[model samples]
Target: AMHPMRSEHIRAAVKRARGNRKEIVNKIEESLTHCLAREGLEGEVLGREKHIYGIYQKMRGKRRAFNEIMDVYGFRIIVDKVDTCYRVLGAVHNLYKPLPGRFKDYIAIPKANGYQSLHTTLFGMHGVPIEIQIRTREMEEMANNGIAAHWLYKSNEEDQPKGTHARARQWVKGVLEMQQRAGNSLEFIESVKIDLFPDEVYVFTPKGRIMELPKGSTAVDFAYAVHTDVGNTCIACRINRRLAPLSEPLQSGATVEIVSAPGARPNPAWLNFVVTGKARTHIRHALKLQRRSESISLGERLLNKVLGGFDSHIDKLSPERVQAVLAEYRQSALEDLLEDIGLGNRMAYVVARRLLSESGEELPSPEGPLAIRGTEGLVLSYAKCCTPIPGDPIVGHLSAGKGMVVHLDTCRNIGEVRHNPEKCIQLSWAKDVVGEFNVELRIELEHQRGLIALLAGSVNAADGNIEKISMDERDGRISVVQLVVSVHDRVHLARVIKKLRAIKGVVHISRVRA
Candidate 1:
């Protein structure tokens, strides 16, 4: 009777009858107490009438007027264990007509935040929907205590029976990690939101190990949810005895089996496809490792490519000369320098120039399109260094027998050539972008495992593929991971990034500057 909307309407009707506000309030209070007493709620039944402003907010969200709202009161029932929670659910069902499809058993799977309950909606005396939640006594206490339950329940919480707590520390640990990687209040809120009210889908592994993930999750997400290493190596997955795509969306009560591949790495594009935090986080981690590997590979190629032009081969470049150069650059060895170059933190041209000078070769003129005789458009061409592409403005460079190296006019490699009047030459795509073109992306995320696989899935979903990825650990817990992917066009890139940022752990997503 004291529910805000109902109470207001009742009081207003009473006022129209020339009844006093003070008398109306008193009468309402007496009626509530009398009803509770009749229900055998003899202990202190503390109640606070909802304020007008509170009711106003609720009405606004619900899009209802004061008179349309019901004055139903809510109560919490606390019991002993998993069994008792269902028992209480039965009791509520017996008392009221249980609303079809409004029942959920979260007690078995639990939420990402360790929230466990059996929730049911029922139609009471009137047709109003009343929500009832039943859980163990300890769940009741934890719900009341909230974050404080981490300390109260401790690490052994899940081990206790009945009234004891469940292992809340594991979820707390995830929260703490997110808190660190979370960039701001909004991002932190989003991360917490995933945990606060996660709808779960339960699946079983081939070994009968049960895994629970967020609703609308996929087979890839389930694979990662089982373990980070398992996610990293998951090549293909099977659902209910049928070989399913990794991006296959999962339903409740399905059996999944992950096919493993040794040395398989996560792809950044996966971020564009996965829904759950576990898959997203693991994808990020795997992408980080894959990025490092790609960086190393690209760096080595650049080093070898630069050295290829030199008259003296790398093996013949004299140990003393190599050692002297390393000492001057303050680097440990050639391998370390190559890794740095691949990482994009070091300049390949500068290092190459230095090595050339050390070999007693005069500095080649930064002129005449670093070209060679008769080596027109058919030679080594950069996939456009600006809008570098197979079908864009290109230029040819003379590089001896290695032939003419073509670059897009807008290529970063050619950006300086326009100012050098002697070197400018118009060029175009020789054939077409015959193979993959590498493009980069920068994504923001909270550090967690398995993020790399989700990113890979995203790329795959967009019809793009990840060639390589690297992460620069930015300060303040946010990571700036770079992905080099093979894409068709800008539209494809945008769609992939949009999907990636929409993922749970992704904070921001954008194209990376080459």
Candidate 2:
């Protein structure tokens, strides 16, 4: 009753359509060329048949239906200046009935990648949609080749002319800034991808300098565009001399002024509304630095308190002992080690003990068990094989330079490192432990709709939070789900498991230790 088109037939159909579009392009180019000659405009007119794959990719990327793609047939008109571009647009509109709302003026507001042009779509022969682009010579070069166009031309000394590549240079500088501020290479790549598509709006400063930002950019983004320091200290803004919210989306031709305060700092909530990569990256970096500074201060206080317990002060330690501790932790300087300790990546007690041992001072015995003050930050790690919670009896193993690893007293992995008694330390939970701990569960269930929802609801009902979830469907009716949930302590976690077991279709559930 039905037949599917073969790949060869599909290719043939595409080729035929391309040929028809090319014919229409030729007709439009001829009309444009004649019209320009009559208008005494000095310009070059060119027509192109877009690649079939390019057209298909664009349609798919934009989620457009087949009949909705209008740029399959394209033309370009390159003139001498911005005014000439407008004149050419006028002539083209007069020649063909331009489609309403299909015109865009990129010349006034260049894209993030520095592309500038005037784009218009028109109804050509047989009602086929034809797309046209008008630009100045420099804009045409950038529109076609982007940043590479700048390097294509050189001055007398084989050097780039000053101000000739200003926009492209600014774009590259922004990319570099983003790379420096990004958390990682993957994040930098994501920021670059966000910057690549430039649906932009042009706004103005009080000085009348035009600034181009991504569509949906807020006053905060505009502040960052003006200067990083301005962004860091921005407290309020005024749009067109009227007080506006910092999160207000900017529109074309609006004059924006940033109000600053010395005490103002970036709020994490701003990340939710910022559209520019520069703003996001800078905000993340500033927050990271701020957190590090706070952690360093906390670590200094913690180290001082711990050293006081040993009757030895951090400042009184010998230079050689301090250098030995620094070398052991691969720290270039004492401040770095302290910052790491403050961030909870390094244990202050561990470093202090090492400093005492190196200085030939008597090391303190394991007189009393250490209390876990959830404030230990990054220096403490719970053993994956044990998943120790606050209520569990835990033992700390001081690994070479990796800091303390806490394990449940009954964990099997404890036996592997038990011979080194010197590395083991007794630990107890504090009266006011502050944060949550992670525990994993493996759930087996009969495949049914809404089972995941029920499982999640059970945990939520029991005051547990799911951190991560993964599912594996085996046969037609069987499935296994793995979940990592945060709990207050062993008692809270056990209650969560009990509630999960009560859900229908749950065949089995057990805590995954390793």
> Which numbered prediction scores highest in lDDT against the true structure?
2
Q: Which ranges of candidate 1 are over 4 A from the true structure? A: 1-72, 80-82, 126-128, 150-167, 176-195, 207-209, 304-340, 343-346, 353-514
lDDT for each of the candidates? 0.61, 0.79
Candidate 2 C-alpha error for residue 218, in Å: 2.7
Query: Against the true structure, what is each candidate's TM-score?
Result: 0.55, 0.65
lDDT string for model 1 (1-514, tens) is: 4466766765565345333334443443454345445554332222234345555656788898654443433334555566756655665576668889988877776665566777777675546455566666667667668646645543375644232233466666666665664545666666567656566788888888767787778877777777777878888888999998888788877899988888776666667778766566557655655555555555565555555555444566677877777888899878767666655456555666776675466643332222222212222444333434344445644333232345556556656664442233344443323455667778889876777887888778878888888887787677788888876545666777776876677887775432
Candidate 1, run of 10 with poorest lDDT: 368-377
Clashes of each: 44, 4
- Report the Cα lDDT for residue 182, model 2: 93
Candidate 1 local lDDT, residue 470: 87
Q: What is the lDDT of residue 494 in candidate 1?
A: 70
Q: Model 2: what TM-score?
A: 0.65
Candidate 1: Cα lDDT at 39: 52
